[model samples]
Target: MKVAPAPSKAEVISLGCRLNISESEQIRALLADENNVVVINSCAVTSEAVRQTRQAIRRARRNRPDARLIVTGCAADIEREQLSAMQEVDGLIANTQKLDSRAWNVPASSRPVLAQHTRAFVTVQNGCDHACTFCIIPKGRGSSRSLTISEVLSDVEHHLSQGAAEVVLTGVDVTSWGHDLPGQPSLGQLVHAILERFPELSRLRMSSLDGVEIDTDLFDLFAGEERVMPHLHLSLQSGDDLILKRMKRRHSRKDAVDLVRRLRKYRPDLAIGADIIAGFPTETEDMHAQNKSIITELGIVHGHIFPYSPRPDTPAARMPQVDRAIIKQRAAELRAETQKCRDRWLINLIGTEQQVLAEKDGTGYAPSFARIQLPEGTPAGRILNVKPKKLEKGLLK
Candidate 1:
């Protein structure tokens, strides 16, 4: 793997989301020639995220007192007034404009340098059109939009040229890509196009997808495509039917189960990951139980359990709220269940060979996104097949 020379002048502190990390790298390139500038690509997915953004702003200001500091990303747009009012914040760029070269008042670098990252993330879509009651992303991101297939191919080509062994298609609503385009191509078509165009590209992965929107074409690729990874992270917020309805989610509990079941038939080793909210408004004990049970039912080894936090102006915020203590307890229980499932799954993989992509962190990831401990001398960005004889500290080695 060829790593780009580190930038000397500009520094970026990416706060959240893989999309922000991808965008921050582009920002880094745009500012590569500039002097004494720092950018904070912030997130406002939760109140906690927004608070972290503020903390980052102050810390960046202290570290670079003479340098110009700029804030951009979802938090900067959604919490514009409050964040801009901070004395430490020099300026705020609109989230939508953050990617444009003009936003930084600089010509786009002739060659955008990818920061020290092993897997290149290529954002195919941005924004969300869905009105999930618990989400404030659409307000921050505006409308659902997609890059044209040609544009996507170009992005993939650039990453490949940068020596990216794996390319991940990422976005706010990745599965919603191409809906606003001319022919309304499905997400599967985008993946097919990339694989067809770049045969040398070994690994092609996708970010979280809306389970209900996994079209037949995408399902087929997941089931049989050798280059496409056998891992799927669904944007499933709850397991109880009522909570899903209240959240304005498109899929029912059964929809998610059936989708996973069908995909696993062709690829029995497929890994399941999900975003499960523990305590939504109006959630009862039974509702939380359903949420806990679904983890084992779906065999969700990589679970992201978010304790429901009310965001300003969201519908869920206005509804009857769950007690914070109970929410915390529920979140803990959900996490424990996920760990049990993961521990068992890892145990089952003992002595099984996995093709792992090494990262700079002295770790690697399998096609199913399972973490593997690499030998001490392994170089970054090399793909190797290794058999794990033990599981230690939640990593297969």
Candidate 2:
């Protein structure tokens, strides 16, 4: 019997969602070694996701031809056949189990996340059970599951020791968290545990949630836990009740409207964001206007506007498809409205102090939860006390 030391040269690539990024880290650990190696986390939510995944694969082949190419994530699940056909990939880990985190937290300079980025991601939950008509996540990522409260606390402690100043708790369906567990612990409780255990962390953030996720328990008391990021990414698939029913989404328009009202009522300065899908099948022009008006009324700080992409296996794929022209037209209109809302929020924050994690110097300033910029000399890594005094029209100036 021979004891193999394991492959020293390997890389892992992921495509789509923060959970995928977290999983790719796990894949790295699965193939890690005490030798020269490179690992790349990939994303494929949009064109950006595909580009990054391809770039990562290409970079590895160019730089480390000897390294084994391992591929995984939602993109792999969605396009497994296509990725499988790629000669570049040496091994494939499709929509399998979650990737462990020990793999890819390495530092370019022996420091995780390097000098500029202050916050690192910690996914407390994985998978989604929702059947939103347009989404294929449940097919790719499987069922709703979560790490225990003790497990999450331990990860935070490890990050704090590794010099992370902030942690963003992420998952596919974060609001659906804890339902799988026996006691059904709430996300708020997890937040409390993290803050209680490690007060050294400067900030904490949650991933997007549907309107059904927020209860009075969270919107009311979350502010008291000052470390929690005062931001929420709520989904408003459509503002029309008919579309809501047609799409089989969980809540009505009023539910989403009231959810924002609660967040604002609880924390007046809270930065609220939203995701609006335009041009689903059977979407009328009037229904589109209803969404635009609802968005205007909600006053969302930022909006991730997307036109419907009919995935192969989703229910919506069987329905009559909206013309690409109509979808594009509506998406352009929604995108303009989204930017207006974002601009208003940025301008409103012109002088308010906010905590920002500096991510490298780019066009002008540091970008954070808010599309805010601190002055030129503002340091990148540490949590900075920033009062955004000016808004550069396009990128943060």
Candidate 3:
């Protein structure tokens, strides 16, 4: 006799970026009661990312043969023709329509509930308008868009009510927020509105921002606001001016260094994070050296290093390509540099008191985003004041 299949449930496998993760949460809530549905919210940031997406699709299919496998997100849209041909996928949702109620065939009243997270991710912006030569995200995400101030306030309030101790404002180009809205208000004004409206929000953090786009209001908050966590992650793709120019980046190398220096003057404890690419097209040894040194120059304790991976239809891909081996080596070097800086920073934090928000993974994150190991069985989402006595394998204990 044939056995009956397991009960159907909705599962979203999200790949790439914090914004994708946040969007997946909304999709999860929308399909909470739906039957045998598995959604692969894919990524195509790099050729490797697309390969991983395909791998994820195949693995998901093998594991859940009876489930309805749907694909969405950047990969679904950007790599549309390729992914649609995969036998494992049943359908594809446009990246823009993935969040719409009608696309999911769910009721319009379905409320977004982030029950699994301790800190909520509130997306205030989406998409990018800039056309950096090396980037293909704009094509995948479409033009920039901003949620109105009122909508942002409602999002923040909802997360606060759900016991989220911290709320992160995330987007593809977060600093680009408010540019398309009425009067084209600066992101600073939007940030000010959120802080003013929600007095109960204990911690307000920002995701990656373009250094050049930071407005005066936002700068002042970073400098003076205690509730605003002392961390800034800049989208500084390269440190060599020539490489930056080739990438069509707005800021120069000095501009980033100067911004960090100025911010640190007012908020000495501010930690710097950056996204630095390695082995970009036409990069010389001096250029690679500049990329490595910027880590130290910016005091970048948190570094996201991406070895240059050419995406289809990008200008940089057409330029003289860097050897794959060299790219791999350079990426490793960047990681070592970042690790050295981070280890030293973590060591210095020993004996200092930190306000940590607990997570289910037996660890918590301090406001500086430092990982601190918690005592076993500590409740998730509990804010603990921890004076770490030692550092253990990259974790403060």
**Model 1 clash pairs?**
none
Candidate 2 local accuracy as lDDT? 0.69
Q: For every model shown, what is its TM-score relative to the native structure?
A: 0.96, 0.84, 0.97
Per-residue lDDT of model 3, residues 66-137, tens digit only: 999999999998999999999999999999999998998988763567665788999999999999988888
| Residue-level lDDT tens digits of model 1 in 166-197 | 99999999999999999899999999999999
Candidate 2 segments whose C-alpha is farther than 4 A from its true place: 1-14, 29-67, 98-117, 362-368, 375-378, 395-397
What 10-residue stretch in candidate 3 is worst by lDDT?
Answer: 108-117
Decreasing TM-score order of the candidates = 3, 1, 2
Q: Per-residue alpha-carbon lDDT of model 2 for 1-397, expressed as tens digits?
A: 9998755655555555666666555555555543544444544444445557767777777877776666667666666777677777765555553353333333322322322135667888877887877777676678998989988887777667767666778888887778899888777777777877876776777767776876555665554556777777776778888888888888898888877776677576766678888888888989899888877888776687778767776788788878989998999998888788878777777776665676555222222267555567766565566676677865443
**True-vs-predicted CA distance for residue 34, candidate 3, Å:** 0.6
- Whole-model Cα lDDT per candidate? 0.92, 0.69, 0.92
Residue ranges of candidate 3 with Cα displaced over 4 Å: 1-6
Choose 1 or 3, whichever is better by TM-score. 3
